[model samples]
Target: MPSLSTALARALTVTAATVALAGVTALPGAPPAAAAPLPPGVVQLGDGEPCPPATLCLYRDYGFSGPAYGIGAGYAIDLRWLPMPGHGGPTAADNVSSWVNRTAGVALLIDEQGGRTRPLFPGQHLEEPVPLNDTVDRVVW
Candidate 1:
Protein backbone atom coordinates (compact mmCIF):
# COMPACT_ATOMS: atom_id res chain seq x y z
CA MET A 1 0.00 0.00 0.00
CA PRO A 2 1.17 3.54 -0.62
CA SER A 3 2.03 5.92 2.19
CA LEU A 4 -0.91 7.90 3.65
CA SER A 5 0.37 11.20 2.28
CA THR A 6 0.92 9.69 -1.17
CA ALA A 7 -2.60 8.24 -1.30
CA LEU A 8 -4.15 11.54 -0.18
CA ALA A 9 -2.21 13.41 -2.88
CA ARG A 10 -3.38 10.95 -5.55
CA ALA A 11 -7.01 11.31 -4.43
CA LEU A 12 -6.72 15.10 -4.53
CA THR A 13 -5.27 14.98 -8.02
CA VAL A 14 -8.17 12.83 -9.23
CA THR A 15 -10.70 15.19 -7.64
CA ALA A 16 -9.05 18.18 -9.30
CA ALA A 17 -9.17 16.51 -12.71
CA THR A 18 -12.84 15.68 -12.26
CA VAL A 19 -13.70 19.21 -11.24
CA ALA A 20 -11.77 20.68 -14.14
CA LEU A 21 -13.98 18.82 -16.62
CA ALA A 22 -17.25 19.18 -14.74
CA GLY A 23 -19.34 20.89 -17.37
CA VAL A 24 -17.68 19.66 -20.58
CA THR A 25 -19.72 17.21 -22.61
CA ALA A 26 -19.11 15.50 -25.92
CA LEU A 27 -20.88 17.01 -28.95
CA PRO A 28 -21.67 14.00 -31.05
CA GLY A 29 -23.09 15.52 -34.22
CA ALA A 30 -23.17 19.23 -33.67
CA PRO A 31 -22.40 21.49 -36.62
CA PRO A 32 -19.49 23.90 -36.50
CA ALA A 33 -20.20 27.16 -34.72
CA ALA A 34 -18.76 30.11 -36.62
CA ALA A 35 -21.60 32.58 -37.12
CA ALA A 36 -21.52 35.55 -34.76
CA PRO A 37 -24.26 37.83 -33.52
CA LEU A 38 -24.24 41.60 -33.21
CA PRO A 39 -22.65 43.11 -30.14
CA PRO A 40 -24.42 44.99 -27.41
CA GLY A 41 -25.93 48.48 -27.69
CA VAL A 42 -27.90 47.89 -30.86
CA VAL A 43 -31.27 49.04 -32.17
CA GLN A 44 -33.63 48.58 -35.07
CA LEU A 45 -33.82 51.29 -37.72
CA GLY A 46 -36.51 52.55 -40.10
CA ASP A 47 -36.53 53.47 -43.75
CA GLY A 48 -33.96 56.16 -44.62
CA GLU A 49 -33.38 56.77 -40.91
CA PRO A 50 -30.10 57.04 -39.10
CA CYS A 51 -28.78 54.39 -36.80
CA PRO A 52 -28.61 54.84 -33.08
CA PRO A 53 -25.46 56.41 -31.67
CA ALA A 54 -22.41 54.38 -32.72
CA THR A 55 -24.49 51.64 -34.22
CA LEU A 56 -24.62 49.99 -37.67
CA CYS A 57 -27.82 48.59 -39.06
CA LEU A 58 -28.41 46.41 -42.14
CA TYR A 59 -31.74 45.77 -43.72
CA ARG A 60 -32.89 43.04 -46.02
CA ASP A 61 -35.55 45.14 -47.65
CA TYR A 62 -35.64 48.73 -48.73
CA GLY A 63 -36.45 51.30 -46.05
CA PHE A 64 -35.09 49.05 -43.29
CA SER A 65 -38.30 47.15 -43.10
CA GLY A 66 -37.40 43.44 -43.27
CA PRO A 67 -35.20 41.23 -41.12
CA ALA A 68 -32.87 43.84 -39.72
CA TYR A 69 -29.47 43.17 -38.20
CA GLY A 70 -27.92 45.72 -35.87
CA ILE A 71 -24.43 45.95 -34.46
CA GLY A 72 -22.33 48.37 -32.51
CA ALA A 73 -19.43 50.35 -33.95
CA GLY A 74 -15.90 49.04 -34.62
CA TYR A 75 -16.94 45.71 -36.05
CA ALA A 76 -16.26 43.95 -39.38
CA ILE A 77 -18.64 41.18 -40.40
CA ASP A 78 -18.78 38.34 -42.91
CA LEU A 79 -22.37 38.43 -44.10
CA ARG A 80 -22.16 34.98 -45.65
CA TRP A 81 -22.47 33.37 -42.26
CA LEU A 82 -25.06 35.69 -40.80
CA PRO A 83 -28.28 33.70 -40.82
CA MET A 84 -31.39 35.64 -41.76
CA PRO A 85 -34.26 34.84 -39.49
CA GLY A 86 -37.73 34.32 -41.10
CA HIS A 87 -36.19 34.23 -44.57
CA GLY A 88 -36.30 30.52 -45.25
CA GLY A 89 -32.71 30.01 -44.02
CA PRO A 90 -30.98 32.38 -46.41
CA THR A 91 -28.01 34.52 -45.34
CA ALA A 92 -27.41 38.28 -45.31
CA ALA A 93 -24.89 38.04 -48.13
CA ASP A 94 -25.96 39.68 -51.36
CA ASN A 95 -29.24 40.58 -49.67
CA VAL A 96 -28.50 43.86 -47.94
CA SER A 97 -30.39 46.62 -49.72
CA SER A 98 -30.28 49.49 -47.25
CA TRP A 99 -28.18 50.28 -44.20
CA VAL A 100 -27.33 52.97 -41.67
CA ASN A 101 -23.86 53.70 -40.39
CA ARG A 102 -23.53 55.65 -37.18
CA THR A 103 -19.90 54.96 -36.43
CA ALA A 104 -17.16 57.53 -36.81
CA GLY A 105 -15.79 55.85 -39.91
CA VAL A 106 -17.41 54.84 -43.16
CA ALA A 107 -19.04 51.49 -43.85
CA LEU A 108 -17.82 49.67 -46.96
CA LEU A 109 -19.90 47.05 -48.67
CA ILE A 110 -17.65 44.41 -50.23
CA ASP A 111 -18.93 42.17 -52.97
CA GLU A 112 -18.06 38.55 -53.70
CA GLN A 113 -15.64 39.67 -56.42
CA GLY A 114 -13.69 41.78 -53.89
CA GLY A 115 -15.35 44.94 -55.17
CA ARG A 116 -16.43 47.62 -52.74
CA THR A 117 -19.23 50.14 -53.06
CA ARG A 118 -19.00 53.80 -52.25
CA PRO A 119 -18.28 54.76 -48.68
CA LEU A 120 -21.28 55.03 -46.42
CA PHE A 121 -20.48 57.92 -44.13
CA PRO A 122 -21.22 58.08 -40.45
CA GLY A 123 -24.72 59.08 -39.36
CA GLN A 124 -25.88 58.52 -42.91
CA HIS A 125 -28.53 56.09 -44.12
CA LEU A 126 -29.74 54.86 -47.48
CA GLU A 127 -33.31 53.74 -47.96
CA GLU A 128 -32.91 52.42 -51.46
CA PRO A 129 -29.56 51.63 -53.05
CA VAL A 130 -30.58 50.95 -56.61
CA PRO A 131 -27.17 49.65 -57.76
CA LEU A 132 -25.87 48.35 -54.45
CA ASN A 133 -28.97 46.43 -53.51
CA ASP A 134 -28.47 42.67 -53.18
CA THR A 135 -24.82 43.13 -54.10
CA VAL A 136 -23.13 43.29 -50.72
CA ASP A 137 -21.24 40.19 -49.64
CA ARG A 138 -19.51 41.58 -46.58
CA VAL A 139 -19.44 44.75 -44.53
CA VAL A 140 -16.42 46.47 -42.98
CA TRP A 141 -16.67 49.46 -40.71
Candidate 2:
Protein backbone atom coordinates (compact mmCIF):
# COMPACT_ATOMS: atom_id res chain seq x y z
CA MET A 1 0.00 0.00 0.00
CA PRO A 2 1.14 3.52 -0.67
CA SER A 3 2.05 5.66 2.32
CA LEU A 4 0.06 8.64 3.52
CA SER A 5 2.60 10.95 2.00
CA THR A 6 2.47 9.13 -1.31
CA ALA A 7 -1.27 9.59 -1.50
CA LEU A 8 -1.05 13.18 -0.42
CA ALA A 9 1.68 13.85 -2.91
CA ARG A 10 -0.33 12.44 -5.77
CA ALA A 11 -3.33 14.52 -4.86
CA LEU A 12 -1.26 17.69 -4.47
CA THR A 13 0.61 17.10 -7.72
CA VAL A 14 -2.59 16.78 -9.66
CA THR A 15 -4.01 19.86 -8.02
CA ALA A 16 -0.91 21.88 -8.66
CA ALA A 17 -0.77 20.77 -12.27
CA THR A 18 -4.41 21.61 -12.77
CA VAL A 19 -3.91 25.01 -11.21
CA ALA A 20 -0.85 25.67 -13.31
CA LEU A 21 -2.69 24.66 -16.46
CA ALA A 22 -5.41 27.13 -15.61
CA GLY A 23 -2.81 29.89 -15.43
CA VAL A 24 -3.58 30.48 -11.80
CA THR A 25 -0.27 30.47 -10.08
CA ALA A 26 -1.51 32.38 -7.10
CA LEU A 27 -4.66 33.84 -5.65
CA PRO A 28 -5.25 37.49 -4.95
CA GLY A 29 -2.92 38.61 -2.15
CA ALA A 30 -1.70 35.12 -1.43
CA PRO A 31 1.52 34.79 0.47
CA PRO A 32 4.61 33.64 -1.38
CA ALA A 33 4.86 30.50 0.72
CA ALA A 34 1.34 29.43 -0.22
CA ALA A 35 2.13 29.26 -3.91
CA ALA A 36 4.70 27.14 -5.64
CA PRO A 37 5.23 28.88 -8.93
CA LEU A 38 5.78 32.61 -8.92
CA PRO A 39 5.75 33.14 -12.68
CA PRO A 40 7.33 31.69 -15.73
CA GLY A 41 11.02 32.49 -15.88
CA VAL A 42 10.99 33.52 -12.24
CA VAL A 43 14.41 32.73 -10.87
CA GLN A 44 15.58 32.95 -7.30
CA LEU A 45 18.54 35.26 -7.54
CA GLY A 46 20.73 35.15 -4.43
CA ASP A 47 24.22 34.76 -3.07
CA GLY A 48 26.66 31.87 -3.69
CA GLU A 49 28.04 30.51 -6.93
CA PRO A 50 25.65 29.99 -9.79
CA CYS A 51 24.34 26.48 -10.30
CA PRO A 52 25.40 24.74 -13.45
CA PRO A 53 22.86 24.33 -16.21
CA ALA A 54 20.80 21.12 -16.11
CA THR A 55 21.36 20.41 -12.44
CA LEU A 56 19.62 20.84 -9.11
CA CYS A 57 21.78 22.23 -6.33
CA LEU A 58 20.84 21.78 -2.66
CA TYR A 59 22.77 23.93 -0.24
CA ARG A 60 23.44 23.35 3.43
CA ASP A 61 23.09 27.00 4.40
CA TYR A 62 20.92 29.99 3.67
CA GLY A 63 21.73 32.61 1.00
CA PHE A 64 23.02 29.75 -1.15
CA SER A 65 26.26 29.88 0.76
CA GLY A 66 27.55 26.45 1.84
CA PRO A 67 28.57 23.11 0.54
CA ALA A 68 26.09 21.95 -2.06
CA TYR A 69 25.05 18.50 -3.15
CA GLY A 70 23.97 18.88 -6.73
CA ILE A 71 22.01 16.30 -8.64
CA GLY A 72 21.93 16.42 -12.38
CA ALA A 73 18.69 16.67 -14.27
CA GLY A 74 16.61 13.54 -14.94
CA TYR A 75 17.40 11.60 -11.79
CA ALA A 76 15.93 10.75 -8.40
CA ILE A 77 18.32 10.66 -5.48
CA ASP A 78 17.92 9.51 -1.89
CA LEU A 79 19.68 11.74 0.60
CA ARG A 80 20.26 9.12 3.27
CA TRP A 81 23.16 7.66 1.37
CA LEU A 82 24.88 10.96 0.89
CA PRO A 83 26.86 12.62 3.61
CA MET A 84 26.01 16.17 4.56
CA PRO A 85 28.58 18.88 4.00
CA GLY A 86 30.82 20.47 6.62
CA HIS A 87 29.32 21.60 9.93
CA GLY A 88 26.28 19.39 9.47
CA GLY A 89 25.10 15.87 10.26
CA PRO A 90 26.28 12.57 8.90
CA THR A 91 23.93 12.61 5.95
CA ALA A 92 22.21 15.09 3.71
CA ALA A 93 18.88 13.47 4.56
CA ASP A 94 17.94 16.27 6.88
CA ASN A 95 20.64 18.87 6.52
CA VAL A 96 19.87 20.86 3.37
CA SER A 97 18.55 24.37 3.88
CA SER A 98 18.20 25.84 0.39
CA TRP A 99 18.13 24.86 -3.22
CA VAL A 100 18.65 26.17 -6.75
CA ASN A 101 16.71 24.32 -9.40
CA ARG A 102 18.32 24.55 -12.80
CA THR A 103 16.81 21.44 -14.27
CA ALA A 104 14.46 21.51 -17.24
CA GLY A 105 11.39 20.81 -15.11
CA VAL A 106 10.08 21.01 -11.58
CA ALA A 107 11.92 19.18 -8.83
CA LEU A 108 9.93 17.46 -6.11
CA LEU A 109 11.16 17.88 -2.56
CA ILE A 110 10.41 14.85 -0.44
CA ASP A 111 10.77 15.19 3.30
CA GLU A 112 12.99 12.88 5.27
CA GLN A 113 9.98 11.14 6.68
CA GLY A 114 8.84 10.06 3.19
CA GLY A 115 6.55 12.89 2.35
CA ARG A 116 6.53 14.70 -0.96
CA THR A 117 5.88 18.17 0.33
CA ARG A 118 6.24 20.46 -2.67
CA PRO A 119 7.63 21.18 -6.07
CA LEU A 120 10.42 23.59 -6.86
CA PHE A 121 10.08 24.64 -10.46
CA PRO A 122 12.95 25.33 -12.71
CA GLY A 123 14.83 28.45 -11.68
CA GLN A 124 12.82 28.64 -8.44
CA HIS A 125 14.37 28.54 -4.98
CA LEU A 126 13.98 29.51 -1.37
CA GLU A 127 16.90 30.86 0.63
CA GLU A 128 15.48 29.02 3.57
CA PRO A 129 12.40 26.87 3.33
CA VAL A 130 10.80 27.60 6.68
CA PRO A 131 8.59 24.54 6.71
CA LEU A 132 10.92 22.33 4.76
CA ASN A 133 14.30 23.12 6.26
CA ASP A 134 16.43 20.12 7.11
CA THR A 135 13.67 17.68 6.36
CA VAL A 136 14.23 16.77 2.75
CA ASP A 137 15.18 13.18 2.08
CA ARG A 138 14.69 12.75 -1.62
CA VAL A 139 14.86 14.82 -4.77
CA VAL A 140 12.51 13.53 -7.43
CA TRP A 141 13.28 15.11 -10.75
Candidate 3:
Protein backbone atom coordinates (compact mmCIF):
# COMPACT_ATOMS: atom_id res chain seq x y z
CA MET A 1 0.00 0.00 0.00
CA PRO A 2 1.16 3.52 -0.71
CA SER A 3 1.92 5.77 2.23
CA LEU A 4 -0.76 8.33 3.10
CA SER A 5 1.12 11.19 1.48
CA THR A 6 1.84 9.21 -1.66
CA ALA A 7 -1.79 8.27 -2.01
CA LEU A 8 -2.83 11.85 -1.58
CA ALA A 9 -0.32 12.99 -4.18
CA ARG A 10 -1.60 10.39 -6.66
CA ALA A 11 -5.16 11.49 -6.10
CA LEU A 12 -4.24 15.10 -6.65
CA THR A 13 -2.36 14.23 -9.80
CA VAL A 14 -5.34 12.38 -11.19
CA THR A 15 -7.66 15.28 -10.50
CA ALA A 16 -5.22 17.57 -12.26
CA ALA A 17 -5.09 15.31 -15.30
CA THR A 18 -8.85 15.26 -15.49
CA VAL A 19 -9.00 19.04 -15.37
CA ALA A 20 -6.34 19.42 -18.04
CA LEU A 21 -8.26 17.13 -20.40
CA ALA A 22 -11.21 19.47 -20.04
CA GLY A 23 -9.32 22.04 -22.10
CA VAL A 24 -8.35 24.85 -19.76
CA THR A 25 -6.09 27.36 -21.41
CA ALA A 26 -3.44 29.80 -20.26
CA LEU A 27 -3.46 33.53 -20.96
CA PRO A 28 -1.73 34.55 -24.18
CA GLY A 29 1.75 36.09 -24.14
CA ALA A 30 2.71 34.64 -20.79
CA PRO A 31 6.03 32.99 -20.16
CA PRO A 32 6.15 29.56 -18.55
CA ALA A 33 6.33 29.74 -14.78
CA ALA A 34 9.68 29.28 -13.10
CA ALA A 35 10.69 27.46 -9.93
CA ALA A 36 10.83 29.66 -6.84
CA PRO A 37 14.13 31.34 -6.22
CA LEU A 38 16.35 29.22 -4.03
CA PRO A 39 16.90 30.58 -0.55
CA PRO A 40 20.23 32.46 -0.30
CA GLY A 41 22.41 29.36 -0.15
CA VAL A 42 20.58 26.88 -2.36
CA VAL A 43 22.50 25.93 -5.49
CA GLN A 44 21.46 24.48 -8.83
CA LEU A 45 22.33 20.88 -9.70
CA GLY A 46 25.47 20.15 -11.74
CA ASP A 47 27.00 23.48 -10.79
CA GLY A 48 30.44 23.84 -9.17
CA GLU A 49 31.88 20.47 -8.06
CA PRO A 50 29.57 17.60 -8.95
CA CYS A 51 28.27 15.19 -6.33
CA PRO A 52 29.09 11.49 -6.72
CA PRO A 53 26.64 9.07 -8.27
CA ALA A 54 25.25 6.22 -6.12
CA THR A 55 24.81 8.77 -3.35
CA LEU A 56 21.56 10.64 -2.83
CA CYS A 57 20.88 14.24 -1.86
CA LEU A 58 18.16 14.51 0.72
CA TYR A 59 16.50 17.82 1.62
CA ARG A 60 15.28 18.17 5.21
CA ASP A 61 13.12 20.96 6.58
CA TYR A 62 14.31 22.51 9.84
CA GLY A 63 11.15 23.83 11.56
CA PHE A 64 7.52 24.86 11.47
CA SER A 65 4.22 23.14 12.36
CA GLY A 66 0.58 24.06 12.67
CA PRO A 67 -2.99 22.83 13.21
CA ALA A 68 -3.57 21.79 9.62
CA TYR A 69 -5.71 18.94 8.42
CA GLY A 70 -4.09 15.87 6.83
CA ILE A 71 -0.40 14.96 7.19
CA GLY A 72 -0.65 16.15 10.78
CA ALA A 73 0.75 19.69 10.83
CA GLY A 74 4.48 19.58 11.26
CA TYR A 75 6.55 22.45 9.96
CA ALA A 76 8.57 20.05 7.89
CA ILE A 77 11.06 21.29 5.44
CA ASP A 78 10.26 19.29 2.29
CA LEU A 79 12.63 16.43 1.65
CA ARG A 80 13.72 15.71 -1.94
CA TRP A 81 15.84 12.83 -3.16
CA LEU A 82 18.47 13.88 -5.67
CA PRO A 83 20.96 11.53 -7.36
CA MET A 84 24.66 12.24 -7.28
CA PRO A 85 27.12 11.70 -10.14
CA GLY A 86 29.57 8.86 -9.78
CA HIS A 87 32.91 7.88 -11.25
CA GLY A 88 34.05 7.20 -7.72
CA GLY A 89 31.68 7.64 -4.77
CA PRO A 90 31.74 11.19 -3.41
CA THR A 91 32.51 11.91 0.22
CA ALA A 92 29.62 12.45 2.62
CA ALA A 93 30.58 16.11 3.06
CA ASP A 94 30.68 16.56 -0.70
CA ASN A 95 27.16 15.20 -1.00
CA VAL A 96 25.99 17.33 1.92
CA SER A 97 27.47 20.50 0.49
CA SER A 98 26.02 19.83 -2.94
CA TRP A 99 22.55 19.25 -1.53
CA VAL A 100 22.96 22.11 0.93
CA ASN A 101 23.84 24.36 -1.95
CA ARG A 102 20.77 23.21 -3.91
CA THR A 103 18.04 23.02 -1.30
CA ALA A 104 19.16 24.39 2.04
CA GLY A 105 16.17 26.73 2.28
CA VAL A 106 13.39 25.41 0.07
CA ALA A 107 10.34 23.28 -0.04
CA LEU A 108 9.66 20.17 -2.13
CA LEU A 109 9.13 20.53 -5.86
CA ILE A 110 5.55 21.28 -6.87
CA ASP A 111 4.52 20.91 -10.50
CA GLU A 112 0.79 20.63 -10.62
CA GLN A 113 -2.31 22.82 -10.26
CA GLY A 114 -1.26 25.58 -12.67
CA GLY A 115 2.37 24.91 -11.77
CA ARG A 116 4.37 26.95 -9.27
CA THR A 117 7.13 26.28 -6.81
CA ARG A 118 6.14 26.83 -3.19
CA PRO A 119 9.03 28.15 -1.15
CA LEU A 120 9.51 27.20 2.48
CA PHE A 121 11.72 28.36 5.34
CA PRO A 122 14.91 26.25 5.10
CA GLY A 123 16.50 22.83 5.66
CA GLN A 124 18.83 21.88 8.47
CA HIS A 125 20.67 18.61 8.86
CA LEU A 126 19.21 16.21 11.40
CA GLU A 127 22.39 15.74 13.32
CA GLU A 128 20.69 14.04 16.23
CA PRO A 129 18.93 11.56 13.95
CA VAL A 130 22.46 10.79 12.74
CA PRO A 131 23.46 8.59 9.81
CA LEU A 132 22.16 5.19 8.82
CA ASN A 133 22.56 2.68 6.02
CA ASP A 134 19.49 3.54 4.01
CA THR A 135 18.54 4.62 0.52
CA VAL A 136 16.06 6.98 -1.17
CA ASP A 137 14.51 7.64 -4.58
CA ARG A 138 15.27 10.69 -6.71
CA VAL A 139 12.75 13.19 -8.03
CA VAL A 140 14.97 15.58 -9.92
CA TRP A 141 18.53 16.00 -11.17
Runs with alpha carbons beyond 4 Å of true place in candidate 1: 1-50, 85-89
For candidate 3, the per-residue lDDT at 40 reads 33
Expressed as tens digits, the lDDT of each residue in 87-141 for candidate 1 is 4237778777777787888887778664665677888888654765677776676
lDDT of 2 by residue, 53-115 (tens): 887887778877766666777678777656554544766678888888888888888875745
Cα lDDT for residue 123, model 3?
Answer: 38
TM-score of each prediction: 0.59, 0.60, 0.20
- Give the clashing residue pairs of candidate 3, or none: 43-101, 43-102, 52-84, 52-85, 53-84, 53-85, 53-86, 61-77, 64-75, 65-75
In terms of TM-score, which candidate is strongest? 2
Clashing residue pairs in all predictions, respectively, total 1, 0, 10
Better of 1 and 2 by lDDT: 2
By descending TM-score, how would the candidates be arranged? 2, 1, 3
Model 3 scores worst on lDDT over the 10 consecutive residues at 64-73
Candidates in order have lDDT scores of 0.67, 0.70, 0.29
Clashing pairs in 2: none
lDDT ranking from best to worst?
Answer: 2, 1, 3
lDDT by residue for model 3 over 22-137, one digit each (tens)?
Answer: 74322233343334344232333333333223222332211211110111112232223122333212211112212221243333323232243423223322211223211211
- Hey, what RMSD does candidate 3 come out at? 18.6
Q: Quick one: how many clashes does candidate 1 have?
A: 1
